[model samples]
Target: MARWGWASFLLRRLTGTFVVVVLLSVGVFGLLYLAPGSIQQTLLGTRPATPETIAAIQARYHLNDPVAVQYLRWLGGAVSGDLGVSIRTGMPVSGMLGGRLSLTLALTGYGTLLAALVGIPLGIVGALRQGRTADRLVVTAGVVGLSAPPFAAGLLLLVVFTGDLGWFPGYGAGEGFADTLWHLTLPAVALAAGAVGLLIRFTRAALVRELDQDYVVFARARGLGAPLVLWYAMRNSLVPILTATGLIVTGMLVGTVLVEVTFALPGLGSLLVDSVTFKDVPVVQALALLLTLLIAAVNLLVDLGYSAVDPRVRLGGRTS
Candidate 1:
């Protein structure tokens, strides 16, 4: 890689982000308009729209314009932080989302942290003890985790921990930082479970592949200890693990909906559900864009994280 690799990579990512956002914005707006009774009926309520009234409404919201024009117009406003007002409550979409942002972030953040903490280590251990009972046990546990989807796992956690054991509270996001974290523990665990399982398998497979490479054999032949050789294998295996982690993070963001509903947390996912239920066009559009940007941003970071993943990888990756 050249020194300009980082710039080239970042520029490429940004351009892709721009294209995706444009297409997504167009699709979301167009599809919403096409959906029967999604916005028109919701906006009109039970009363029929007279020609004059229909014209006025269309003019006001730019509904009469072509989709491309409408998208560009909306895009202009969006770049400046104006997401428009929520049709349901007349609240600024940005403000509404901001209010619930922290809790949702906390939940997803905690879940990702937990998944990494639990998954990576177990994966390492499994790889080291491949074909052993411990490896089989780890694989079994991962299957169990993946089998119990977030909602079911959440419910079970609520019943056993909150109901029987009385170890944690059942609902609400709680108040204050400490209280919030305390409240989110079970939900986070439930959210992290599937991700943990995925990471375990991904990490194990990656490490195993890396360990079998000629480089690892050469290192061993050079008299480096097992620990050092294993460390090198682990380091080389990070690209896949990081890729999986990025996906997990994005998945957690979207996956929060069911978990929030189950745990009664007021996050973006729940907000999105309610917005869609009420046919709040502005809120839904804003959220769709937000989630897309977040996912794109994570992928960009992961891409940047490649050679940058381990500085030693810079020869082939960015930051050379």
Candidate 2:
């Protein structure tokens, strides 16, 4: 595609993503507003909800303002890098999120890497073997992985690895890089199980289709080795794999709440759960917005990856 075409595509996608973020913010804010109980109630804890106390709390936090005005103020603050103080902790939401965000990102990164490393090769082997015993075994494993929920899988891992065998630490993000990796092992495996299953299935299907194409057959017929031919076929089949990977990574990031809770990890997912339980609207809003932004950014990267992987995929035109 031409430079102008690529730029136009990016502009359109960015504009659409921005609109989505705005709508998501509004929806989250509205839901919080409609939730039962006032922020003052949460702030007061066991203290009596006296009129003077309520009035003072309202004035202090502008809680009595119109819903639209409150949202606007919050949005303006977010734009200025101020996500407001947490009602539960009385600390800046950004500060509370900083370290936790890094931990979550690390968990997601490690899980995704593990999934890709295991899934892609197994898929290729399964596809090449077709109906052989190895293929059947891979298929069965994939089915089992897909059938099990992350929490269930996590518990199973916890039982076997932490309870019986005593292999890895059961919880926490740990202290340093090596310790963190050690602690994250089981959680990452549990988090990646479903993704691995999906990738195995997707990769096998894509490779099967690619191998049936005339180009693959011709390449093999030309006396190219099996490895070279398979390599070429894999390249041709990458688009679907890339798409699945992006979705898997996003799901892992957003769905880490259960895994984090299971492992007692202090990540964004756990933070989100805590914020919701405590009715900390500012923290909840900020986290929700951050997740939405992450999804949008990943989608944009996937679109760009499409053009990179497939030469025929032009930005603003039919595949050439």
Candidate 3:
């Protein structure tokens, strides 16, 4: 891989990421502006409010400003690391979000890890076995996993493990490291269910494709042992499998939101849902921007990883 090629690829990805973030910020602010609700009423929560009180609240948050002006104000504050206070709790949005960041990362990381552990081997076996009964079973399980949504999976896990079997707690992020891992077990599994299926299918398909390539044909014809030939196939299949992995990991953000809500975890996903329901625009916008950044960062990493995995992208002077 050439140094100049890597520089150009990185520069392009950074440019794209910046554009996406800018668009997301504008879209988020605009949608909230058009969102039907009274922030004053939401803040007061059924309390009686005089005309004077309402006017004061509006002025305090500069709600009277033009929508574009308001967006610019918010954007400025966001750039300075002050995302403003939550309308619902009057707490700094950054601080509030920071407290819950670990659990969200943990959920996402654990889910991805679990998906890789379960999916990769099954996918390889399926590809190797091809049309056998084992392959059929693996394919069938993948289909079923893909068909089930995270929320439904969470509920079912809760009922069987937490409700009936009493194997795990139903909700709450546990206190310490061990407890938290235990608590997050079900949520992670629920979040990863669909990803597992996706990985299984993607990995199987990638391996199958690699195994049929000319390289594999030559390797076998050269009298390479079965293990050595399969190793060649596995090594070549990494790029596609990595592509699937990147997608699964990013897609887990959405799944994390659903699973968090279903499991009642105090993470960004539940916070987002609650904030939106209560018309907490600051929290919602902050979360939206943060999530967008996270996704963009993951995509950038995946792009870099592709070059590393198969230096052809860099050496060939092509950005894929």
**Tens-digit lDDT string for candidate 2 (84-152):** 788788899889988688999999999999999998888998999999999999998888877878888
lDDT string for model 3 (1-320, tens) is 37877787778878988998898889877656566666677545455788998987788778888877888998899888899888788899999889987889899999999999999999999999999999999999899889989899999999999999999999999999999999999999997889889989989999999988998889889899999998878877888888988898888887788789998999999999999888787788899888888888898888888777787765444544
Candidate of highest TM-score: 2
lDDT of 1 by residue, 1-320 (tens): 46565566667777988898778877766655765764555555445778787776677678877877878888888888998888788789999999988888889999999999999999998999999999999999888877878888999999999999999989998888899899999999999999999999999999988988999999999999999998888888999999989989999999899999888888998999998887777888889888888887888788778757676444434233
Summed backbone clashes in each candidate are 0, 0, 0
Candidate 2 at 115: error in angstroms? 0.6
Q: How many backbone overlaps does candidate 1 show?
A: 0
lDDT of 1 at 198: 92
> For model 1, where is the 10-residue window of minimal lDDT?
311-320
Residue 33, candidate 3: C-alpha displacement in angstroms: 1.1
Q: What is the lDDT of residue 59 in candidate 2?
A: 86
All candidates: CA RMSD in angstroms? 2.3, 1.9, 2.3
TM-score of each: 0.92, 0.93, 0.92
lDDT of model 2 at position 274? 94
- List pairs with backbone clashes in candidate 1: none
